[model samples]
Target: MTASTAQQVVYDPYSAAFKDDPWPVYRRLRDEAPVYHSQKWGFWALSRFEDVRAAARDHETYLSFEGIDIDDTAKDMSAPGFLPDIDNPRHDQLRRIVQRTFVPRTIAKLEDDVRRVVTGLVDRFADTGTADIAQDLAWPIPYAVFFDVLGLPTTGSDREDLVRWSHGLKDREDDDPRLTPVAWDALHDTKDYLAHVLTERRAHPREDLLSTLVTAEVDDHDGVPYAPARIDRDSEIVGLAFVLFLAGVESTSALLSTAFRELARHPEQAAGLVADPAGIPAAVEEALRFDAPLQVAGRTTTRDVELHGVTIPAGERVFLVYGSANRDERQFDDPDRFDVTRPPQRHMSFSEGLHGCLGAPLARLEARVALEVALPRLGRFEISGPLTRYRSTPNMRVLDSLPVSFTPSGRTS
Candidate 1:
């Protein structure tokens, strides 16, 4: 990890090499160059735990107006209502619109519903003894739950179309930060779908979050007195729905699949969970820390900041490496090991501060319930097929497929 080796350390977030295994590069960055600059991508990165956490908390200095992805998809802020692209006082204003629905107490009420969904999914393959956990369990649970939360149509061709479009929105090219044509089509179609849903909700109001958003209002800060006004812009509303759908479905999917895959690798830990179901929550947290779904968060520095004798100029994109920071030895003991008994520690997987993930509570609940229900049924499971990574933006780390074989219970719930 000398300066020459550091210079040899090419950290390309979008490159296939980095995606295959980023931990080694992350280690090099943290050890040799704490504040590493990627000249090719024209962005600076902070890989250390403390640095990333501080930047995430300092929303003023490390502004998020540029969006959280290093890609061009949200850089210009063309996609209205993408929450990560918005800054306060508008950020806070918009967040308040749907924040209550995501609070722990509110999300807790959905436990039964989440469990039902998990049970249904797990039952589908429970008797078969072999299943692609990612496709069969991880991906669909969040889709069913979040779509229900939004009151979106989750049946027939409507659900099929939404799932297709959602997957399209996540498409990304290797070693490139630009959105693919398929992604663009998916983006347009999703917005169009949301627009149609919003219109329907307007015509026939429902008791769901989307209907609430249709009639929601916030202070119009552009005015002198800042009077309360209805959110008139359709793009803003659509943007809100879009981000929610994407984050809600994808992040949780990644979390669940990763947890299961790791558990298969560490059967002893899985055994620990089966012996004591209460440990499932801590296991979920450990999974998040060991391998975060969202790898990096992007921000723009409003002022020049000095770190590790490296100065990042004002108004440049900075990558807060959440995936790397979570594994930093400076923060966690034996950070590389996946120990279910590891002490509860704060990790940047869900991010931090004002712009922290709104759906984290729901994600945790889903993962916990998913493992709780699936593990007992999947006793002593082993990976049965080739593993594949999800083809997504550089900022994400998720499996596209995880096939597992286990002793079949010969019964379904």
Candidate 2:
């Protein structure tokens, strides 16, 4: 083990001040204590760009089985590990199944579907002159896309149920009731709801992710599989769905909100996309890196590790502040400035290496088409009301509400 550092670092991710905007504190931590140790959380932290990138990249040393939520309880830990956390052979098998549904070829088939959905939201709001972007537009896109891909209904109470549950999971410790063990109740219910979906897919397997997983086979890493044709675990299926639904809704919606906010704040940038639709994809990438939906992620140390000469003991959690790292001057030039043409630099927004976001391409495509389709059609829109930022979890930077004014294209010209 490397020598332990003298300075104790305290940056509770749950701290009230840190939630609203943590850049200043993160910047200080990067320079002051690159390997800050927090006894409050009983873990070590890596805030600098180099440290965070390295931690995320070295999945062998810093594994993600710990789960993303800083406040995860025994219940959460007890739940089956999802795509984001599972390691190796099993991960590869499950991923192959999940990927079948979300790959570009499959998603491209839904371009018309996405465009139709986008048009409906914009059209409804165009006549009304008001709509909450996060609620009405941003939040529903992914759910619509997900369910449509799965051959499920995109309407009814499940939409509302999922939305509330989604927000509940992201709230600040005090604000988001889901922060407590009480959230497990909701998690359990969500599990039940998703379980039904699994059963439905099993009974009537379709050409979707669940159906594919229902039929896919896994071989043991030790080659101990009784049969390669065995069915996947049902509990794992439901657990992965729960995670997928949440991941699909939360991060994409957050990114959408951020993208909309950026456009509203910088009409010129919005105009740039509107003028040349080709630029929207690049714009989305910059927005992703600039104000990432997932601003922080980490790994739990499997063994004692040395970070910048500071020893992080085994079995301790290490915070990898990608929100800070994304803006690191050392890694990105003019790191704070938001430019649409960022040349697709490898930012830690989706993280790196083994556990990086599996839905990256899908997310990027969603963002690109969303902004391209909506911004031009919704004539002149701006944040007409007080913006309500989503509750900050250690893992996400999201806006809860973005009330806006939007005029339709025909009505404008």
Top-lDDT structure, candidate number:
1
Q: Quote each prediction's TM-score.
A: 0.95, 0.88
Highest-TM-score candidate: 1
> Which residue window of length 10 is worst by lDDT in model 2?
225-234
Off by over 4 Å in 2: 1-10, 73-78, 158-160, 168-172, 175-178, 220-234, 406-413
- lDDT (Cα atoms) of all candidates against the true structure: 0.88, 0.71
Error of 2 at 289 (Å): 0.7
RMSD of 2: 3.6
TM-score for candidate 2, residues paired by index: 0.88
lDDT by residue for model 2 (1-413), tens: 22243253346676666777677777767777778877656767787788788888888888767766556532253356377767665567766657667767866777787888877777777677677889888877887887666545567788667656655554446323135544555566666776776666767888766566555555435443221232233377666666676677677888889888888888888887888889888888788778878776656888999766777888887878888888888888987788886777877888888777777777776777788778876656789998877764556777779998877556753
87 in model 2: Cα distance from truth in Å?
A: 2.3
